[model samples]
Target: MPKKAKAHASRQITLSELVTIQAGYPFRGSIQENPDGDVKAVQPRDISDLGELSADKLITTNLTGKRKADWLQQGDILFISKGIRHFACYVPEDMPETTLAPSLFLLRVKPEYQGQLNPEFLTWQINQAPVQRYFDNSAEGSRQLNIRKPILAAAPIAVPDIETQNTIARLYAASLRENALLHRLIHNRQQQLNAIANDLISHS
Candidate 1:
């Protein structure tokens, strides 16, 4: 753990104790692009490397009563359990009624532990380099690495006071927003340069 993380560690608890972690429902049918479908499904690709959701790739489907428990809610976190790189995405309040794909693990803070653990903080913590490394090491499979439920359940998380957790989560969110703006700015600049180059070439 880094010095800053160590300083924040007022107490330690297994991830499972703080949040209920369960694998997503396995949808036997294909993920169709039905905007009018009853339910939206969040696939692994829908989560970006920065832990933000990309709605462009989200697919809609009809979920049955048995899978209602998989419905995502605000403050819920989705973990990419299978893949070369793992990502943790925090669900936002404005997201439509959505459910996770089979490749993800739904992380919901236990009601009793909700006051003690902030969902944003837990999601940010899991995305941290140290915790990511732990997941990387625990991941199984030669071609496609997959994190098992037991490994995630046993992983330790540092829990600071509620105030500190909120502050950290706020800072993390600000950084992500800043990063997104920077990316857009860079893309615009690149497009302008490409357009100018093409105009100059045409004139020459």
Candidate 2:
């Protein structure tokens, strides 16, 4: 591999290799709602948390069956099939033991490929420049762009070697965490500085 490749190049694997299959998000009106039940549906805004799904992200489902629930698993990945093209992020962690929400496609990987693709890495890649471009190109609607399975599967994937992919995944995950921590730290320091200024002003 070239030198720059080490920085950004990946093995480029087929979508079929690392993915099991795709599930479409149900239309908002199509999701069966229960008046007495409590389920917090996840929308595009819920894809953050370093690409991890939060417990509150689970939405209510009127569908009564085990198979539909099986679509979400501990390590299964959630991808936004609609909305902003570049907003196609993945859920990094396990799905909460709750009803899976609609408007997002769920991609469950087999146990054999667990370590091959990290949810965080895949999420970052999906939101990256190249893949985002594919989504932009594939989107066919005026309001919210719609991304089909073919578009996702055929999107050029620059999957580097396993080792490199692992590194990239780790780096991606760590950077987000560190950035969040840094932001909090900065906020706290700012508050302290403001307090000190307030004391000086009061004394003066």
Candidate 3:
């Protein structure tokens, strides 16, 4: 008979063993602007429901020089840490190039050397509930659980074949497009309703 599958692999990798990021940046909301074009700031609320660096709420600040420069960009992934209790999250959508303002760990996928990991899949994996629990277990501080890059990378992870990873990434990309479409539809409907209400009030 063929060799049966083992109950478990003799070895397993952890999260902290994945990539390289020492710690996450925690951008507070207080530093965030209230949505005027003149200000410059970012906050967790700026993270769209779809997990992306959504449109930002600008705030008053003299944040210039190098600080004024290194903003966010499209296709960049960021990890949200701090202030929140014990959960791992990411900005799912791509922001305009040069819009950095969140306390998030900017993730750059060196595609040339990710082994068998699709960066998109990894994004989902990290934000996964089970994986979040791993971080929770390793949390150090009292209120905010801090996990350094080493520990974050050492977390256990099992990746499938590259073909499979690519397949998952394709699906994920499709889903993201769908989500954006849905959002646009909703927004258009809301606009229509508001216009109708305004007309009725004005005509009355």
Tell me, by TM-score, which candidate is best. Answer: 1
**Best-fitting candidate, scored by lDDT:** 1
Instruction: For model 2, name the residue pairs that clash.
Output: 10-159, 10-160, 11-159, 11-160, 12-159, 40-59, 41-59, 51-92, 74-94
User: What digit string (tens of lDDT, one per residue) describes model 2 on residues 1-204?
Assistant: 545533655577655567765664344465665655544445556666345444464456554434545335555566777676335445544445344445676666557777776655666677778877778877878897777777777777666667776777788778877977998899999999999999999999
Off by over 4 Å in 2: 1-10, 24-40, 49-67, 88-93, 111-115, 186-204
lDDT of 1 by residue, 26-142 (tens): 777656666678878888888889899887677777664465546678889999988887889998774657787888999889999868778998889999988998998899999
RMSD values for the candidates in order, in angstroms, are: 3.2, 4.7, 6.2
Q: What's the true lDDT of residue 179 in model 1?
A: 93
Structural RMSD, model 3: 6.2
Better of 1 and 2 by lDDT: 1
In candidate 1, residue 98 scores what lDDT? 74
Better of 1 and 3 by lDDT: 1
Q: What is the TM-score ranking, best to worst?
A: 1, 2, 3
